[model samples]
Target chain A: MSASDYESASKGASSDVATFDDEEKGLFGRFHHALHATPALVPLIVLMVAIGIFAIVLGERFFSPGTLTLILQQVQIVGILALAQSLIILTAGIDLSVGAMAVFSSVIMGQFTFRYGLPPAVAVAAGLAIGTGIGAISGWLVSKVKLPPFIVTLGMWQIVLAANYLYSQNETIRSQDIRDEAALLQFMGIRFELGGAIITMGVVTMVVMVIVLAYMLRSTAWGRHVYAVGDDPEAAELAGVNRHRTIMSVYMLAGFICGIAGWIMIGRFGSVSPSASTGVVGNIQSITAVVIGGISLFGGRGSIWGAFFGALIVGVFELGLRMAGANAQWTYLLIGALIIGAVAVDQWIRKVTA
Target chain B: MSTEPILKARNLVKRYGKVVALNRCDFDLYPGEVLAVIGDNGAGKSTLIKALSGAIQPDAGEIWLEGKPIQLPSPIEARRHGIETVYQTLAMSPALSIADNMFMGREIRKPGWRGKLLKQLDRKEMERLARDKLNDLGLMTIQNINQAVETLSGGQRQGVAVARAAAFGSKVIILDEPTAALGVKESRKVLDLIQDVRSRGIPIILISHNMPHVFEVADRIHVHRLGSRLCVIDPKSHNMSDAVAYMTGAKEPDQHLETA
Candidate 1:
């Protein structure tokens, strides 16, 4: 056999994606093939299919410009959370603290608006800064203390939950207090007509984040380092990539994304509860979307685009089920099945490629 | 022969608690030569290479790169001194593309007025360089430079790792049992590549247990028995059985053999 055959065999064993004949394609074709062949594409395509089916079922109800904008607005907060979770999962770790951290940050923002009486903009900024600080501390504990991510993040989740309750004094902050800061409240409220339908500012934030994150993963050194650390920390270190530093940055980015999600949540709901979003089940949905979108829990294998499509798929599924008169129980069953099917497909794909 | 050797380790020693790994090991590597280090499982061959590669600091010894005595703090320090190593497992991230693995931490930047703003990878240049380097060793079968290393076979992965070391301008290429995972035919192909590298004036430190392949390519052979050097011999002077006997500590060093 020739050397190319040997190289192709190695590539197949690692990626599970069949190598395309380089002779048949140039640069653009190669990149096209790369995108199509990515494991994450399966879920993304599935999401697009779900969207089409939903629009057909709901007709103008789902496809109307207003409905489309609503879908974007509704998915934006969970989408950000999913993106944050993707970063952690890509490192073969999880941050159970994300939901609690976001909730805690919201409570802190409530304090800024109600107790301290800070400007809404300042309150928002302070709330986000607190989230960032907590994230930095957690990152330090994990990387410096060499704690298992699961243990550290789990402990952090509980700690933040308790902290949120204590700060809010187990009371729901009034919507009036939060809305008084017009600038802060309008951050996610900025709406304009798009093809005769209003689109919220939340959609813009989600779109920009998706683009920036996807570009970073593809082009930047830090992005490469993230992949490297997730792949094999030992090999990455041998290559001069600092594993600790990369992991710290990943957690920080995860925290920052959670802060964005919290910001959207407060803007949309106009209130903060110590236990807000407790029964929403958005975390499970977001994680399931990520898995369906083809981001591997094994780390170093998925992209933010996958996270985007994953979120879209979840949103479409929920909207479709609701239109079909499906109860909350049936929606849960459907989501559970999708997650299982996605995981099963991922395993099958991995085995065949290996 | 024309100049001082590229890398030398004298009195190198290492121990893990009560277990000694490397014991006063002295080694010399010259340009355009393949020094085959052959031994049994517990012969301290790996320990010596690990110390030399700076994966583990020696308990007592001096490592001289280009005739300068320097302490190698880590693998990065060793690489900085122009020493590249290919471990038995290949030590490559299977998820990354071949070009990405080739450049890795040292990627070539695309030519642009703005450095970070337009800091795209010089894809054409990287591919061209990779292809040329592989072609120089007559490896033209690999068609796609974008293919991930996980897609390649054991022998192909071996070639990539070796190609990377050569491409990086390594003064000494330390390969730890490169053919340990290959089939006979594939192993022969890698052996041929080793010969090609030797022809190109790149010294190789080949660590392997296979005696026939070692004798086939190595000009000089060193045997280690129980963490210490038993004898250094020209492959032409002794056959496979003699080398094994020395490595297993079943025979004494013959005085007639040339000593370093």
Candidate 2:
């Protein structure tokens, strides 16, 4: 076979796949394609339906602006934490230390302000630095030390939890004291009325975090690298992506976000307490939001907006159930079903490898 | 043919836990030539490819690219010097869009303040380039440019992978078992793709065990036996049996055939 023969024989020989990209037929295929295109849709639809159901059942009680705005306020902290978790999860890694890291940073802020007599702003900065530095340690362990992310963050969870207890000596910083001395500590508690809903600054912060992080993940090279690294680390490496640097940077950025979550913790509770439920309930709840929101647990195949919608779904369930006079515990049972259902649907959608 | 080799390897020795995988193996790839490396399983052919592609560091070897000795300690480093490899797995991120997979590591940023200050990706430009490259291979039949790679058939995925290598691989392109898992029709497409790449004047190092495919497409075949290059035989002058015999240690290559 001469080179000229190859050219003659090769002409017009396209092995184009016949079934490629034919508009998926039938409801199942169309739904799969739809879910594939917009991962956040599942949670969004679930959220809308849950709200509609409660509005019909509870009438004016559920449809009121107070109840609706309160749901957003309640999920705001978890929403911020989910943003941090989504960053790690997108890399196919989980950060079990999110709540512990946030609470620990808040404790550090209190100590810096009261014990050291530092200004509230300076103390808050120190807290942010500590949170980021601790996250960097976890990143170093995962990237350089070659440790599994789950194990590194699991061990970090315990260590940071213990440190929070020891450092704060179980002291609670009162809201009055924060108001008199370090007013900046309670900054996110400030509220304003908007379109019939009373919106807290904390809710605004969470919304801003989601919008900004979503933009970063969608529009930047670093964002693409995150998906690549999560989708297939080995493949990403072969394509010239610095896997270590990317992983390290993700952990560090997650940590910085967790730090802000800590600052907002103070505003949400009106006090700095080591025993805040953010540390205890935050880890599981944020993960719950991420899962229900439609982000795959396996990594690299979800949207950050899915997580926000996920948190909103839980919020709707909680507020709706309470208004309907049903046990709030029913919210857990339904959410448990949603998480498993989301994963199953994700698996089904993932089979579109035609 | 030019006197200088475009890519050259000498005395590449790699040992894994007291087992010598590549024992002083030598290889040469000339400019614009299809150099097929044929060997039995465990003949160190893959180890040789890995060393050349920088997938693994050779304990001792000198790799010369266009007459300059270079150290290839990693796959990323090899790609830096215009050496692209399409692995047996195709090494693609299946969930990403076609343009995203092609520009996985090197993404073009948007222009002006949005790009310079915000570090935003210029997705439109990348999609245009990806479409152009695929079209160059006459593979523009697939309509959607943003469709995920997983949705494409096996042949189309391999086509995208090949187009990617041809687009960015400024010097050498290596394809490992490109048609191993393909049907006859798909294999024909890949064979055509190889010839097309060679027609574009880029040298290719094809690693395969299939004799017919190798003989049909390769200009020169390098036989590997006992962890080293037995000889380099010209496919134009030799037949399949002689090449297989040399590789399996049943026949010794003549001195004239060795230097071709």
Candidate 3:
């Protein structure tokens, strides 16, 4: 529009548009500014408030180290998956195959150790590679082939799920066999009592991941590129960012993280089963966490820590409701309301124009 | 005014299906001058600049930068050759802070081990440079350098975009209607900005529909017509009506200033 023949654009910047500062004068306005400054704060606050309510109602028993650590352990799998999901969603893309990829990767690790007689560590490495390879395929399709991530990952989810059953023959590597031979495969399940709380290796891994990814997103050039590509690919391209490379790496990195989750999934479940339907259920669980975490599905708007808080929020709700003798269905009802409320708040925060 | 042209385009031709966007169009930009490109809707000014900025490749043409023929297959390639373009969209990430947007692709890294091994960004230095550039452009009203671009007013955003171009556009800067999305006061600031950038000795190619703005900042006006350059008129010699008449074909130059 360098040589716009009509004076169409100048008409937009009138007195009304210039009056953006006028509206930012009250409590709601301050909240809007705070949310705009750090979107993840909303999920963090929600998680704390939920915990406070549960702690007050259930007394110190509910807030004890044992119960708190149990919450971390329960959320380990979904927390890791949501980390991967958060990266994909921040780029305005969704990875429907995330769950299938993790499950399929676990199946590969278990089968390779048994079928090929490879070292347990080697088998674990193979699983991570397969996970990353699956991500690369999805990334290639989305970044280079320009396919919509939704469709690509949806098709990938089906393909990977079917491949899991076919390749693993729906076999279940029992906990007994794994514990006997592949003690290394269950390394993430190794637990220790720290100050009367049982902390699993899987929880440690998730916390470390959240910290590293959060730092990378805030302090690295690559992280900035991810947000830029997600925010506006064309803009990033014109600004000299290799948009395709950025997106391709994001998917690959998400895949690598998912691969790690798969390894941890073994630790969490203590078994590698091709028919573990819980892995399939992980897809929706991660998305729910991300939405409630205040990460805009539109992309490039939330913190990775928000996803961690999001997963914790769900874990807290489930445990709190159960301890209060509430029905399991009540958890769903409340989470559904939170999802809607989160999106509504996101929209409100977005309306803040300085 | 008699020095060699800094940027020259010769016999450029571009077509989209049956539509001829630029037919035998020619352009020349001298150093340290604001060259205003004025034309009607279909006069091919947009296409002409796109070809020059490497947004679209002309079917047949030779773009000479500093008297050397260069091929710009992509905008990145054009930027590498020290030609920066501030597009109509401003090409900025809205969620990013002003400092991040300023140093989008060419971010500075911390010195020493952390820089080499961990690849840490020099956020402090980048923010400082960004603030300096904005300050140089008299855009210091922005309170926080860390504020996201989306929070800034439209005029302030434009100021940032222009400042970015001026800071890094070493050879030439192409501004696509920089003031079109701004109010009267904002447009006035941008006009001042164009003059300020020109004062720093970098040539600019400004395309605008505002004839008064065109006349105000322009040293030479390139009037585009029928998908090509009609003539280059001195803004000092011609008024707004004359430029409009030349562009709309109501009148033509007595003799076309075809070449620089």
Candidate 4:
């Protein structure tokens, strides 16, 4: 059915429900009783349509396996990182330290593996610990100290940026001593051939992570807590939800994911450079992907899949600009315009719907 | 009805610095009855509700549930005792479906990740329960509980909130200004819902400024004046003017038998 038709039906059903007696209410009441029951099929459908349009425009080049694989590789780190930001945004909070945190943790990993001669697994763990520890501190400030997440994370962003610089001493780690794991980096970079389409391993991992996170947000009890805290903390508390614990958990989860993204970035670039990925593409792309995916910045209104689709939208837009021969500076300008446009449209839609 | 009061508050006091919001107030909620709290703005009506709901800790007070003294440290603690509150904003997410909002923070989950994917939210069960809850209060024309809350009219939204509290097994439902933003028809809908809740044996505390509503559903009208519950009068015995005069402290309570 059409969108308006479905809405009208819902409205009629709600009115009819007002006068019905308890025992008489039946099957219609069973399968579709949630207030947020409007399925997000529309956004998913729109994403697919956008992909089709891009494919048609890029023609043979976009349809090629090599190009598809390249896009996946290009977006892997930020795609996963954006998923992290989506969780924070879902709770009506922001983590400005995400990019810097990723860089800082990767620096730790570099130190562990290259400078201190630690195992890869140990280095990975060290990176995750650093990232998650910072996240815990930030979460504490937000929940316990009652600081705003935006300000807390913004300050952390600066701290982490400075720490990363100090930790690196303005030098790039170029040690080739760990040559035994060259294949490991290739493993992260490798692609599998399926039905004439090449999808990188990182792409598969990111897709799975996105689906899992989305499912967790939609189907789990913890997911409900996240939405509840975002919707109204006082009411959620009255309903027996642990608002502080959920908020902290969301921040910690975001940190853990960024940690993983850090390792993935190191693998992709073959080295860690302090200046190379500082604030990495401005974090604008990550935010853009999330908003474009249909997740509201206001929280309690979007999904993790929206973050995934948002990333693809960013990927497509970047590819489109390249195909159109736009200058390097225009890429940032385009993304900036898109972010503003998407947010404005979202506000407009909410007003109309409300 | 049990002999013991389901909920009680004594010597409840709250001060916002120097401003006394609630002063030495005492209140009780019995099983299977509707209690109407009437007062002008700044009469500490909201403050009393907040204290009862565990939104804030009272400076000096004791609460009891089922005859045992209790401490309402936070709202979560209040819900553990089966108290739910429907606020002025309805405490619902407009972007979500009605059933989702009703069952939020207490969602019915499947067994595992696989179950979550295959069985999902037991959506059918939640919807059935939601419908039954709504129907219990004579609110059953609603065909799709999956619809977003943004689509519903004001009365419908209020009704849905009442239904939500009922569905959650709230033994005492405190409604704060449920009809303030509504029109005449909508207000009547909410009043009927309160009565329906009372009929179901759940005590309801209806906080309203509308006297007609007070007389319509309230078994007892408790008037708050100058930071205290001046007096409680049976609706059947007191007229609107008598209640108002007492509420504003314009007329002293008449107790001919006592000398103070």
Error of 4 at A238 (Å): 4.0
Interface RMSD of 2: 3.8
TM-score of each predicted structure versus truth: 0.88, 0.95, 0.93, 0.87
The list of candidate 1 runs beyond 4 A from truth reads A1-36, A112-126, A140-146, A278-282, A351-354, B1-3, B113-115, B254-259
Interface RMSD for candidate number 4?
Answer: 10.6
List the candidate 3 regions with Cα displacement exceeding 4 Å: A1-28
lDDT of 3 by residue, A100-191 (tens): 88899889889999999999999999999999999999999999999999999999999999999999988899989999998999999999
Q: Please give, for residues B1-260, the per-residue lDDT of candidate 2 as tens digits.
A: 45799999999889999989999988999999999999999999999999999999999979999999999988889999999999988888888899998998889999999999999999999999999999998786667889998888888898899899999999999999998887666687788899999999999999998888999999989898777888998887888899888988888888776655
Model 2 alpha-carbon miss at residue A201, Å: 1.9
How far residue A142's Cα lies from its native spot in candidate 1, in Å, is 4.3
Question: If both were scored by lDDT, which would come out higher, candidate 2 or candidate 3?
Answer: 3
- The candidate scoring highest on TM-score is 2
Say which prediction, candidate 1 or candidate 2, comes out ahead on TM-score: 2
How far off is each candidate at the interface, as Cα RMSD in Å? 7.3, 3.8, 5.8, 10.6
- Global lDDT for candidate 1? 0.77
**Which portions of model 4 miss their true places by more than 4 Å?**
A1-58, A181-187, A190-198, A278-282, A352-354, B111-120, B255-260
Docking class of 3: acceptable
Give the Å shift of residue A137 in candidate 3.
Answer: 1.6
